[model samples]
Target: MAKQKKGEKAAAGGLREQLRVPAGPVDLTTYDTRATPGFDGSKDDGKVALEGLGAEVSDWQERLFAEGRKGGERSVLLVLQGMDTSGKGGVIRHGAGLMDPQGLKITSFKAPTPAEKRRGFLWRIKQALPDEGMIGIFDRSHYEDVLIARVRNLVTPNVWNRRYDQINDFETELAAHGTTILKCYLHISPEEQRTRLEARLDDPTKYWKYNPGDVDERQLWPDYMDAYHAAIERCNTPEAPWYVIPSDRKWYRNWAVTTLLLETLRELNPEWPVPDFDVEKEKKRLAAT
Candidate 1:
């Protein structure tokens, strides 16, 4: 596959190539999710993958907090978008579980309230943006305006069509404001989703997770795929590139997200700034006390 030029729309072939996953439903049986010598999420190698990822996150968190103390505010925003039963919840649970909770915020967006709908599609979303020195994770983000709304025909063609550019501008503004945006679309095959959905129905403990509406949504898989293709093509910008993560193997998905996040945070070079205080005066004050 040819490399997509910068600013060029990502074609279906290019996305599949970049993600390193087969074009259709993947057979999870062929791949190993267990921690091994090479794979990051293997449980057998003392869960080395998870431990290393956790350490990397901790280092970044320390730097970010130090920078925060110094009054240099840098923020990170992670957007996760995917189909129903695509392991978005699990990814949030395991992937973000290692990060410092005090420095991180997770917001899961559901259907908008009547008040929110009265505003703009992005009104509620922009309100959730991360503050400086914080990491914000969106379980389902603004992409829904383009994806589900398009799939379900909730909005007019012209309205949803305009959202592609709207989203790009919104993200670019975030990047300009010293917020690093990492967008990931958890790619899973229909079969994998079906299996997971079935597991939810069969287990009593997981039954609460099962929703009848999911079946209706699955029926429109083709529509969703088309919407996803268009949304990624239109909205993936140089400043905020979308990563299509192969999520059939939960371990791989976790490792990929964690690694990407660590690398992005490391690149920001978060550090503690110098305090504005007179050392001698402070010491004298302490002595007097």
Candidate 2:
């Protein structure tokens, strides 16, 4: 991953290009959660890079919003999946925080209630979709069906096994209908996760964010890793790709995700759209008044 060009966007190659999970059986074990894959800078330098991207990210988001208002069906949906304390919240707060909230939809999926369970996994997900011309972020997403559902044995092997194909079909439909999907698996080491979770317990203000159940889930790390590996492999397609963000370092995580998104939006090249009305006539009318 090389530095971006000054006046031109290196949308086709660079950090974003390297982060994407290739099409095949992905071994999460081999991915270095601690390695800052594309970034060769210090933590402070990463922070500066992220700051530089803010205005550009906002501009791109506004253009996409305008494109939607002008009748373009295109939009973006970012799906985030990872182990607990993998910095998903940090990404939203720091990365997505740079964009306009009105143009963004953020959904945090929790354990389904009885009513939701009756309707099926994606039922609740469908309702949270971003409107045309909007960008959507899923803090946790539909992949929970295969991840948690499989690990916890909430669904039978035969059932969860079939969900991979179902998810692919669902994403295919969304892509065909004018949505660009970017799914990210935040890669964080177990050691870092423990440190973060412990810090949460130590800070009274952060206590509310900690769930004891997360400790239970830690015991199933190998299983969850397997689940993630399968999910990434089965769902990684040309239409929608998965990017594994090395998230042990929060600064690097923020920089990498923001960089990828900036490249994506730039490639989309959303325009501010021509006004349907006559601009000169409107200007004349205003001037006369």
Candidate 3:
């Protein structure tokens, strides 16, 4: 994998190779939250780099959407997992915002209702899956079942523990059925989260976005990190690899995820569907009419 020079795209597989977590024992402590791997640029450069990707990504997205509508089975599912204020929403707003809304199916998963809980953790997830030829973005995804459930003890240890295997199997099925899965764990430091939370509190307009519960959740940071380690370790597969995005800098986080999605779209390489009818004949018929 080549490195990404300032104001340039990464070498083929550069950022993806740099950020992808290899299968093995995982350590959250060892990963740096502030480091910008692959991207060697200043903040302004990073913002410009991200802006440059909008046109290409949107073009590829439309191609994929067209392919899907023309009996294509392929699609993409981007699963975003992060702690409070780690910028999942920011990535979506800035990254996926580049694509056409008609081609995107964005799902933000909240705490499950009693009925959802009864149906099982993945039931609602399946419901929100993108149709053929669409790009699906999950702000918070099924991994929450293991992460939050384990840390909060929302479910018994046995149930959440068993979900690790279930998730891998489910993703395998999805991959087999032409759904490309890209899971990103936005890794941000506790200090950065505090700063973001404080900034939100200091601004009157941001009060609507700030939640009192986020402060409470902050106390259990260690427990949540441990849960994340396990979930990434157990569920990280070739079919659905997890990328640990260093998210302390909001610009880099948004740029990195967007680049990864662009790469995945390029790999899919969806093209405009061919017209079934003879174009010259149709043109002639139309001209005569």
Candidate 4:
């Protein structure tokens, strides 16, 4: 496949390649929230692929974990940013769920506490980054500083505007330090968001997941969209690229994310670290015992 020029939208191809956000200005309207572009499979095929990916992900994660345990410097951080009801949790449940809990670090960022605010935005975020040889998932990450902070006017324009540079510098540093960053923006339509929110009200089981504030935030849809567009365009870097996953169809969303992650791990090719001790000696000692 030919290389895509900077800011050129992804061409029709593999699922991971198609969903990648091109470098430069991003107009969210160009992406279809409901269409499964690269996936030619049925819903069942998607589901089965997801399930199959789980095992592959688990094996790779174990190797990564072992690599780290044996002093390898490698890790993965998956940043998930989306509107309410966009299935961040679902991706965690269905995709990351298959990995060993010990090797996976998942953090769900909420509103900053008093102390967290005093320290600065990225302080707490720095604390949650995954250690070597682990897979870290950020349910709502530092990008919230740009998205919600910009939309809600939590900070001055000077502060929020500068964050694009700050974030780019931060992620670039992460990439230099052996962390593979995969940032995903779950793209969902306002109409689809409304339907999902309404379903929460109708089903008692999902009531706990509903937040009344989400409805108010929905009122600022256009502002949030603009915020997202700016964020993706400004911070979409070669070190840590962004993938815009169409999320109206939950199955496709899950499948696409899993596939993207699988592809990243495959590229990283984290191998099990070589043993420090002699295998023959250890085997002989065990046999003698």
Question: lDDT of each structure?
Answer: 0.75, 0.89, 0.92, 0.88
Clashes per model (N, Cα, C within 3 A): 3, 0, 0, 1
Pairs of colliding residues, candidate 1: 34-42, 35-42, 35-43
Q: Runs in model 4 with CA error above 4 Å?
A: 1-14
Query: What are the per-residue Cα lDDT tens digits for candidate 3 across 126-165?
Result: 9999889999999999999998899889989999989999
Model 4 deviation from the true structure expressed as Cα RMSD, one decimal place: 4.7
Ranking by TM-score: 3, 2, 4, 1
TM-score of each: 0.84, 0.95, 0.97, 0.94
Regions of candidate 2 where Cα sits further than 4 Å from its true position: 1-12
**Model 2, 1-289: lDDT tens per residue?**
2344232234448666889998899998898998786667787877877878888999999999999999999999999889999988999999999888999999999999999989988899999998899999999999999999999999899999999998999999999999999999999989999999999999999999999999999999999999998999999998899999989999989888888888889889998899999999999999999
lDDT of 1 by residue, 1-289 (tens): 1222222333443332344333344333343333221243233332345445686787787788678667775788999988997778877788788888888888999988889978989999989988788889999999998888898888899999998889989989889988889888787888889999999989999999988999999999888888887877677677787777767777667766776677677678786667689989999999999
Candidate ranking under lDDT, highest first, comes to 3, 2, 4, 1
Best by lDDT: 3
TM-score of 2: 0.95
* Model with the higher lDDT, candidate 1 or 3: 3
Q: How close is candidate 3 to the true structure, as a TM-score?
A: 0.97
lDDT tens string, model 4, 8-38?
2344455567788988889999999998866
By TM-score, the better pick of 2 and 3 is: 3
Q: How displaced is residue 16 in candidate 2, in Å? A: 2.2
